[model samples]
Target: MTTLAEEVLAGSRLALARLLTLIENEDPQGEAALDRLFPHSGRAHWIGVTGSPGAGKSSLVNRLAQAFRRPADGSPPRTVAIVAVDPSSPFTGGALLGDRVRMRDLSGDPGVFIRSMASRGALGGLARTTPAVVQALDSAGFDIILIETVGAGQSEVEIARLAHTVLVVEAPGMGDDIQAIKAGILEIADILVLNKADLPGAENALRTLRAMLELGRPPHEETAESLPVVWRPPLVPTIATQNEGIAELLGHIQAHAAYLRQSGGWQVRDRSRLQTQLEELLQTALLKRWRSSLPEGQYQQILTDLQARRISPYQALHSLLGEPPLPQSIQRGSTALFNA
Candidate 1:
């Protein structure tokens, strides 16, 4: 069979979609494809858009794409890739797939590629293979890639760890829901966007956010000695539906990207993300090997023994492995796999 990577490199839309599906399913082929493409990656600028449901993140992303369509002087027109994630309906295990509907105009543009992904109950607000898919798109020469989350609760913070710039969207009348966002989402935002800014209570919400940000700031260094530390982040307001303030938003994103690179934060963040990916792959492989090495018919007996209180689950697991779990420090070492 012709591989998805080959098709994607050849600019096949259907092949691109199939590759995304394979990665979403975490198929073994997906890993192989990623390995084949990794050398071609790192060219795209990744932007993550996330917030509460109904925050208009999809619209915001579409506007962002339009803004990024034309690259600066001497540079080629930018190609954008969008990954929109939606929660799967429990009854059917399928996403509503509504983001694409709002972005239909860009669908026909060869420069823009959009893919909708169902969360499929992946923890941390991303599909397990999302990073790999992003890498593929980056390698395929997309200049800008945007990730839109399902807008679930706090776990969506995971998006921050992936993107070079993160825009946290909010709308009017979220009320205490904004407070809920403060608990986790605030820290992750490189830019705070008040979407649906035309709505009632929008100004009030913006004022509240400003106050919250001010309150979160650290006291002046010269201030009369002892005070608690606080952190303040930049915020912006936008009506993404009307495309208002989008240019400014893009400017901020560019500025933030510059800041990350200048301050060395870009390399640090990228290294951390790569380390996390490596650890996850290693852990998955280790678990699979451990599971496959078990004697046939041994699983049921282990489960039964643990359930019946004949032995602790830990003890049963040890018996299955024929060894105790490796210590944390050793697991960080080169010999960890042999120990496992």
Candidate 2:
């Protein structure tokens, strides 16, 4: 283990922040530390919050975090981690990372750690390094880790695959009734939230979401034979700024967490997350080796052929794979492009 990793496990917030920065920058050493720290992970509950841009998700997260840290809940004080993703430049693919300003109130609490990350133009409403960042926090002994996505509309359901529990927030008056509760976003919601519930048209939004949920699944039926039980997501209304429904929202979150543990879903989700992490790392390593082995001029010619549709991609791959290895001076793998 690196000295930094030891410090992070020892509860040094500065060391944890430094490690996260390394992962954010895609430093190779960051990956090595994650590998060393993997055994210490699988301890934190991963929660993801996603919604449209104006859904009051920031306030909602802040309130929920405070509730998690509250000692009056009959449990000891627990540590929490927050990762807020914000959009960055399209040209440079950098992030503005202004989400921290909204969460500044949570600063300076030794039990809370909030990180603002740039989306870096990733289409999933999350930074590419988010999983690694979550792993870092998990290894550092955080109890609950909440991730707030960029809220870039329906295509941003990447949280479903990344988090153990996903809270999908919606605000009234954002769109037409039917258009507001699109199937794409609803399918991924483990808990649906109707934020801004004090605003006009809140009832209509609630009704629309309720009706949509009714139409979404077949209700449980008593059968002659025993059947499996399934979880149905409940929609909770909240006015975050006023702290309305915050306790109820958290109650649902805790119920979902308990359900996951009781149903063995936690282990299943952890396996899925680890599989994704392994595949991503393997893809990076393979791509790096492939680029390193390419004998210069040969790759550009392939790109030109691909652009002109003069040759199929499979044909190009086959040709490249059939080619001899890079010259000995290159010091890369000495085998052929795709074969020994």
* Best candidate according to lDDT: 2
Which lDDT value does model 2 have at 243?
Answer: 85
Model 1: which residue pairs collide?
none
lDDT of 2 by residue, 188-237 (tens): 88999999999999999999999888877667753333332456889999
Error of model 1, residue 337, in angstroms: 37
TM-score of every candidate relative to the true structure: 0.83, 0.89
- lDDT against the true structure, each candidate: 0.80, 0.87
Q: In model 2, where do residues sit more than 4 Å from their true spots?
A: 181-183, 221-228, 312-314, 323-340
Stretches of model 1 off by over 4 angstroms after superposition: 1-7, 70-76, 177-182, 218-232, 309-340
Over 1-340, each residue of candidate 1 has an lDDT whose tens digit, in order, gives 8677787787887877777777878788877887787888876788999888888988999888887885443456678999888888878887787888889768668899888887887877777777888888887889889999888855578887788888888788886645744557766877888888899998888888777677666654432333212223577888887878887888788877776666666787788888888999899899999789889989999899989999877778778879876566864684666777
Q: Candidate 2, clashing residue pairs?
A: none
